[model samples]
Target: MWRIFSFPLSQIHPAVLALQLHLPNKHMVRFREDDIMSNIVDRERDKRTMLTAFFLKNKADETKPKYLYKDFPKHYTWNGATRTWTPRILKPQRGRIVSANPAEGERYYLRLLLSNVKGPTSFEDLCTVNGVTYATFRKAALEIGLIENDDSLSQCLTEASLFQFPNALRRLFATIMIFCEPGDIRKLWNEHFNAMSEDHQLYCQSVERVQNMVLTDIRAILQSMGKNLTDFDLPNLTEEDLQYGIHREVQEEYGIVVEAEDLCAKDELNSDQKLIFDEIMTHVDNDRPGVFFIDGPGGTGKTFLYKALLAQVRSRGLIALATASSGAAANNMPGGRTAHSRFKIPICVDNNSVCNIKKQSGTAELIRSSKLIIWDEASMAKRQAIEAVDRTLQDIIGVTLPFGGKIMVMGGDFRQVLPVIKRGTRAQIVDSSLRMSPLWSITKKMRLTINMRALNDPWYCGFLLRVGDGTEQSIEGSYIRIPDNMTIPCTDRQNSITELINAVFPSLQNNVHSSDYIISRAILTTKNDSVDEINDKMIDMFQGEEKVYYSFDEAEDDHHNYYPTEFLNSLTVSGLPPHKLRLKIGCPIILLRNIDPSHGLCNGTRLICRGFQRNVIDAEIVVGQHTGKRVFLPRIPLCLSEDDMFPFKLKRKQFPIRLSFAMTINKAQGQTIPNVGVFLPDSVFSHGQLYVALSRGISRKNTKVLVHPAKDFKQPGVYTSNVVYREVLLDG
Candidate 1:
């Protein structure tokens, strides 16, 4: 059924299929076939004879093929259209082909035949057929002109086995090769090159560039091995070299550029404030030493402009220091220190120390070191105090003038209270003498006219702003509001106050306002029948918190004098004395005899707590630092004038020694809280005390006050009636 081609067959071994064909006119072709059938029996026999001879010669080497030829192809097909002929090129399709002494040309033909075969083959198959090592087969292919002599074979092999290696090993190999022979191996790329599109080619180029850069860096690293390098000595390279080197390389390949810039610029202020701040900055830039005063009523934005100026100075790399009269006020501004604490000025005690010039040198050194100094609450700072500070600066920095510390900014309103001092007439005279100096006269003064009060109620803002200003008209109506439920018996006033507090500040019952609530007990001066009983009750009331006491006699300093301890001892022998007891700052007591208020002696008036004093004998109580006076209260009431009503009746302690008391007027100087309940009793109406108390209400929405129901108590004067108040309310 089939037409068999008549051709001379070559007999080759099953394992070594090597046959070379000789065409007409020395045009040679090679193929290896072990299963081809020949129609001529004689030719088949000749094939068998050639294969046996080849096998016999190679039988000694076990690693090589046992025989070179066993079966060979005897048939062939010719294609006239292609002008070429096809032959079976693999074993089992033709008779084994024999090659007793294969020439280089014959070997090339055999390789071409092997490469053209349809089935898969291994390195061992090639070795068995060619009778050589795997490496030998590769070299022989190059030597016989079957494949290129360059590293194309190696590159192809690497690419084929790339996925077979571990990731780390592959990376290491790539690094080594990229660095060692970058240019020499560029042309020997494998299937990855043939498969890439135009876009991928660009990507590959970027990858190549990064690889080259890495190679260069590796060379540098090798040269610098074991050498020490500091951060300052390192090269200042661009971020492109630090991050995404491949991305940077890709961008370079695509001709893309990115630019980065630094951010450093000043911010603009509000329109009106801008003009004022700009002028200040101009003066500071010129290095002109002048006192710039920013005086405003409580609500005006003087502090905002001050901060803007500080910012401008900092932007120019200049230093500015801010200081205030007290620690509380110092904390209001950034980087602020208390003026007295910063200068180490001793607190004013007596007339001698108030005008003293011996402590000036140390203060001057601090002033010389600073460029700009801002003193807040300047109104509270006394003229004598300012003079002492100025003298100190003059002694150290040698300026001898008000602007001796360079640029100075003082901010305050003079409507507030003046400084407290002993020997009032002498202190005033000394203070006046310092203000007369010519150097103190020429500081530039700026007044803030615009009121930017943060209160929603206009009346409240107006009232606070006009407190110490004499020109402003007083609002006449009583601001105190006594709730309907507060009309309880006089004995229940404490319970009513407690109930009112709980209702007004419901959140304060928890932790929110815990620190703000403080209870103070009235001190008992007379050792009467009720004294021991009241002290026991007071001790029970102040059980958990700190209790402070003021003793009457030196002997009372012993534990036996304390009423709480006495009561507790009577009840139980092992009972402990109250542990949280501390002494109050100011406590009032009558002296055994009459003493003058002006002669540095405590008479009947209130004794303020200046602070404590120490001496060798013992630490004695210092009553008022302002007047340089001291006194201790006694358990027995001291009889004053015989004509005085109830001569034996104990006087109320002048200074409340139990706890600190900030009056309604003192509390009104600063911020307004969310809710405030004021107790305005009839006793608080004397000498504009009502006015001060009413102004302390601060806000209509947040403030509530309690007052007496009696119409007679509303009279004006020191005790003014409701007549002028009603008229003022109508006008408003």
Candidate 2:
């Protein structure tokens, strides 16, 4: 009879000690464990029986490895003395290399090594051994491939059951590994660790754990990222650490340097400008807080006076904060930024809103140090935005005085563009202006009558003032006739479009590719539809390979009802690109998003397309201080929240650029171009639309009008209607 014995104890389950199997007449039978162990093995057949039983007990009976008793040596052979079988050895597989390039390998290796970096000395030594600067180390770590393509530290730690470094250092460096802004991180580390004394560095390296070194870097990084550092329970850094960070932030933000020679000489100020300048300087000399609103039409040197004031205060070593309502206007001012960006004002402001500023914030400290605050284009800002800054100022300076004891100088032409209130009535629009604010009661009013752009063409400038004031005679139903010299008439729609295009884009055959030439002149339209029509027409005229781009449009969420794709493609709105946007290599495009203001990718910035990729467009800036600088713009998702326009939340992914051949009048505001052609295919829809459009050209000779005769006009002439809210002109 055959009996079972254990083959090897290590590979056997503990359940085998209590189990036994029996077979009789080739039929399997069950027996007790004592019966199987007590019987000693005597033959090869019995050894095979023991191995088969062991394998069957561990897994399923039918799926067990089948082998004849004589064929057991082909797989596993049992040792007569040791009672154990030796398994066949297998070959090890080679791993595929993720990075074969030496540079890429170094980048991966550096990231892995830095992931365990603990102290300043360790980090410094790592950089030394690598023969790379701290900036280079940061750049290597920040390379997208290093983190995404390589094995993750977390995955490795999980597999190894312990991190490569101490737990505290591991966790801290893990966060640094994921930091997106490498330049900001590098700057933070340089500012903190590099400036530390040798004794303090030693103490952090030897005495305290890695958390202390990591905490210091994180605090500086958070502060630079515009986060309130007070929220974190961090250890107190040195006074220099606190002060240098604030100073660096402020310097980077408001640090405008105007060459002393670039400033307009004192003798260059006209009589009207001199009067306003003298009054402003008197308030500055007295060191008394005052709120003054300087009103002037477009091209009347409001920006010139603003720059002069900035230069004067900055030359005197006094803090003067210059900000504008629009990015274009802000770019023209030395050391200027948008008021909302500078003051941390909420984007969507209401009556109860206040600036998002804390008493101990860097912004508050900058304001406290400032002796004057100059907000240009004040009339264009919503009253709520202005009041928000006022409330925050009062809270920070600990004074109820206007603007918190800081002299406030505001300037803008109300006749140009007032506060934009979407779908608002005339009353709603007029009430949103800065003049309607509660603080307007204590303001001093100053007016400028001279138009610097039209100094040699006073008659044309006077006509513009009349057009802005609505004093110009209405030809029929709020329409006015365009002068022959300032307009080119056409007998047909086709002829009219051709004539207008030729007049604005003269010599297009020679300069279509020139960025300077393209931006020197642009056609203005009152509506976005007309702008698109003109842009498509102009792109057809440009000589280059045109690349067409289509956006991915969809509902924000797909829950219950599914909207048709065809219906989404049919929708159009302002402040958004069309479904199909076409561009040539040399075509100029305006940015729609403020992606990187430091790199001049702000809204309203004009760039010339240099090249195109699948997801991004390479372009060179042709406007503002960053002119000739090349930048890459990627396609981003944008959503419009106008419930009045769409039934559901709609998102479109497209490049943040639009053709610059023509733009809406609302977009043309705060811009001064060399030449402008107002294409009045449709009349102005709201107040100040006509003023903003007609005032863009630098001079009357460079400006022209091509209008389609107003509907129902009995008079035989082109007509233009001016929009003005007289209530905004009222002074408290």
The Cα error of candidate 2 at residue 560, in Å, is 5.0
- Provide TM-scores for the models: 0.39, 0.67
TM-score of model 1 (CA atoms):
0.39
Off by over 4 Å in 1: 1-275, 349-364, 422-440, 471-496, 499-504, 512-674, 677-698, 706-732
Q: Compared with the true structure, what per-residue lDDT tens digits does model 1 show for residues 467-543?
A: 43433442344333222332222235456444444444444324321223321112211112222333343334332
Candidate 1's displacement at residue 474, Å, is 5.3
lDDT of 2 by residue, 1-732 (tens): 454442432222222211221211212223455564334332223454334433433234334464332233455544557655444354422211121112333333333333222221222344443365543443433331222322233222232222222322222222233322222433433333323323345455643434355455555445544544454434444433444455545555455676575365445788988898888888899998899999899888888888778788777777888788877777676666778778888878989899988777767888988978899888889999999898889989999998898899998887877888888898898889887788888999888888888888888898888878877887545777676687868569768877888988898979966778888888998888888888999999998888866665677675532653334545676777776779898887887765544335566777788876444466787766667766545455677745466668877767777998898887778888888898887778887888788889977778888887657566666666766676676332
Give candidate 2's error at residue 276 in angstroms.
Answer: 1.8
